[model samples]
Target: MGDVVEMTSELGFKYSILASGSTGNSFYLETPEKKILVDAGLSGKKITSLLAEIDRDPSDLDAILVTHEHKDHIHGVGVLARKYGMDIYANEKTWQIMDSKNMLGKVDNSQKHIFSRGKLLTFGDIDIESFGVSHDAINPQFYRFMKDGKSFVMLTDTGYVSDRMAGLIENADGYLIESNHDIEILRAGSYPWSTKQRILSDQGHLCNEDGADAMIRTIGNKTKKIYLGHLSKENNIKELAYMTMENQLARADFGVGTDFKIFVTSPDTATPLTDI
Candidate 1:
């Protein structure tokens, strides 16, 4: 009898932050067979140019997934979807909230896919799982994407990381997590008491220490990269966030550039593409 042979191709995934931080948020993800966008917080013009910078065409995107209807996350969605004829996916409540606010202008109902918490959506060669997160939005959710055996998790804009969130992030190959503010600086700064309280609450954004704690708990030997994101313009500095996260991880016996790679994204400008 002749020997039988089976052939399989290795899967590849690549990601880049088109923009990050409170000023705006956008991320680009590409696998061998799909191109996906996480958010469109930047202006349409900027998003288009950023795609060019990364050697990708806006029209080539397979889909645009929205985490919430916050202005910083939906600012450019209308223009980008209209121009590229791309479909958008969000939860039913999120879509309803967006429509009530006229956030994305007039998107076709047929083009909007309503996703619910705990459901998995498939696109091209990737599978995406959306789970609820603590954020001030109509049913806010974070994403976990898996292709072949590699997985990536993106958790941002949450005030605190719950056990459920940590469970989702465990053993991820790549992570884009929030490190929004310094609690002491925010408390002493000029912002109103109400705003500060909101930011520090469970539904608000994560502070540096909180973010670092989450990273230390979730990171594993398979975690290849971590990008600190959504820094506050007033209370947080890039250096402070980076140093805090690095120091905390060191206490846990993980060193940056040795145990894993780390990077920071800016509110403006696209970060270089990273392959996983």
Candidate 2:
């Protein structure tokens, strides 16, 4: 996940995981005519460096879309939007929380934009659709982007993906879903009981098993690429998460490399530019 590459010339759709995990999370997406970041959880400097590794400049980004108001997701949103003069889009509830808590410091009024849930947001050539998720934050949501008859879905920071959500994201060309933790490991870990309970709750993060089930419910013939994102640093191991998903999918007769490829995103590095 460390190698950097130049943007592809033939790209109708491409994306890279700038970083993932509890420490920080961000995604970089490119269309033929637009560049956008899904989240900016790291410092502005760190995010800029990650972009530079992939031959991207922060200023080149057209928009910054927020999934929630959590610090890990909005840490760099304000800084990047202010420095680059980029639009910041989020649902009204999320925007209200951020503004009330001053989570994003002083973004210009013009740069602030609101989007409705379950509605389509057109950003350049990409048609973006957002859906609510079971998260602790007020009105947390995930997104699916469609372009050129292909779709790419990015889902994380959710406790579970409901049947309705599965239907909405089904049959996409690519998916980046959360595989946050291992249940056994989390129970055995040193986290306080309350914290553990919160994580295991319906409004907390998804465990490996649940994440696998969510994927199994969705994913149609059009699906080819999958990314395991937002893994826990202490409660889960990378290899364990990968094996859990692989074995679970295998039970359903879906071969990993044959049905689709899975890539694990890193908390500190950028994955290679991947085409959707």
Candidate 3:
């Protein structure tokens, strides 16, 4: 994606996707005092290049936060952390799963702060609130980050939006929500029945309609940016997902690009830095 300049000059939370979607998932979040990485799904080389693209280096990251133990989320976590000597933070279940699978590199256990569901944890200048998301994992959690009076929520790998998740995401300045698939397309596509069922199950990925519905329910006046992420390459298209969300938001009296900026992140490359 091309760089989109910020229209507003005011300083706020800055976010960038080093990579997103099925190929890989990584994000960089910058507060006034801390620079953090949300995931490291991409390769170490790719992550380094993406950081350089944004005029940053791997050593600059204060910490690397993981959402789950999925390969797509932890592909380069070990490499990056070992290279930069950065900490990896996640919930106890996540850490346990990773440890059981021998996925972590050599690092200080104290640095691997185990986050609790619905509890707030402070890391540098950012306060992170992680909650359980509907996904097939030992303990997959979505995150809500607050810093400098601005808040943003990042929710992906979710199958359905629970009322609790909606409440947590509402009224944020930015949202990185999943728009994983188109149900009809997925159904008609040539996949095994069991595989398709898993994709449609409550523990699977969210459909486009589900995502749009959640956006309508949770978005507030303070929501300034919305990025549709983790889209399926086979079952969904960027234009279709964008149009679906745009039309749905229109019905809710919110105009895209006017009420809030809309962006789509790539699974293989870094998206432009977005500042709220």
Candidate 4:
């Protein structure tokens, strides 16, 4: 990812990816009032440093929103929330599994927030709408948030996106989506047969081709930015992921920078602040 951020003169919601990929995943979203983190798959120290880069303090966040109980998504959720005494939000099933596994040990009961899948929840001025995603987890969901007349969709970790889910998120101004792997590379790679089979299954992750195809199908007039995340380190590279999607869109008669900006988030570094 680069430092070029799509910015406007007016004050609005700002977003940045702290880290994204198989090792860990986390991102920051801020309105003028609320500071929210999508996931804390990384360590507490790493997340804090990333926040420091953006001149934000860990204590400033209003809430930490978890997508699922996978370690890559919630590894640091406990430590961060405990350190800041912050509110943590997840669906009841996710919370139960995490608690049962002792993944997030001893969180404040009052600070634990829950929401129902396929329902809308409000946090101050932000409206959070979650829909079930076909991931191999205990009722995983993809989040759609609306605030100040603008909307964003966070869709990732799912094996495939259903048409109904596509329609639900088509109107988003910003979409943070997964471009996990390359089909050919994955099939020919050195991983074991069973692991590869599971990955290629519907309950696994999305491949680059499928993700791009879905994006093109669901893209709307309101769409402004497309973030490509959750890349595979061994099976895929950044250039391959970017070009595969870019070329597909180009073939569909959509200019890259002109139609909508595409930001390729890295697994290690934080992208520049982008205002939406």
RMSD in order of candidates = 2.1, 5.7, 5.8, 5.8
lDDT of each: 0.88, 0.91, 0.86, 0.87
User: Each model's TM-score, in the order given?
Assistant: 0.95, 0.95, 0.93, 0.94
Summing lDDT over every window of 10 consecutive residues in candidate 4, give the lowest-scoring window: 6-15
Q: State in Å the error of residue 132, model 2.
A: 0.6
Distance from true location, Cα of 62 in model 1, Å:
1.6
State model 2's lDDT.
0.91
- 232-261: candidate 2 lDDT, tens digit per residue: 999999999999989999898886889798
Clashing residue pairs in candidate 4 (N, C-alpha, C atoms within 3 angstroms): none
**Which pairs clash (backbone N, Cα, C closer than 3 Å) in model 1?**
159-204
How well is each residue in 1-276 modelled by candidate 4, as lDDT tens digits?
Answer: 889997855455788889889899998988766889999999999899988888888989889989988988888899999899999989999988998889998898998999778999877767889899888899798788887778888888989988988988886888888899998999999999998888788989989988898888788777889989899997787889989888888888776788698888887788888777
Which candidate, 3 or 4, has the higher TM-score? 4
- Candidate achieving higher lDDT, 1 or 4: 1
Rank ordering of all candidates by TM-score, starting from the highest: 2, 1, 4, 3
Error of 2 at 252 (Å): 0.4
Clashes of 2: 0
Answer with 1 or 2, whichever has the higher lDDT: 2
Q: Compare candidates 2 and 4 on TM-score and give the better one.
A: 2
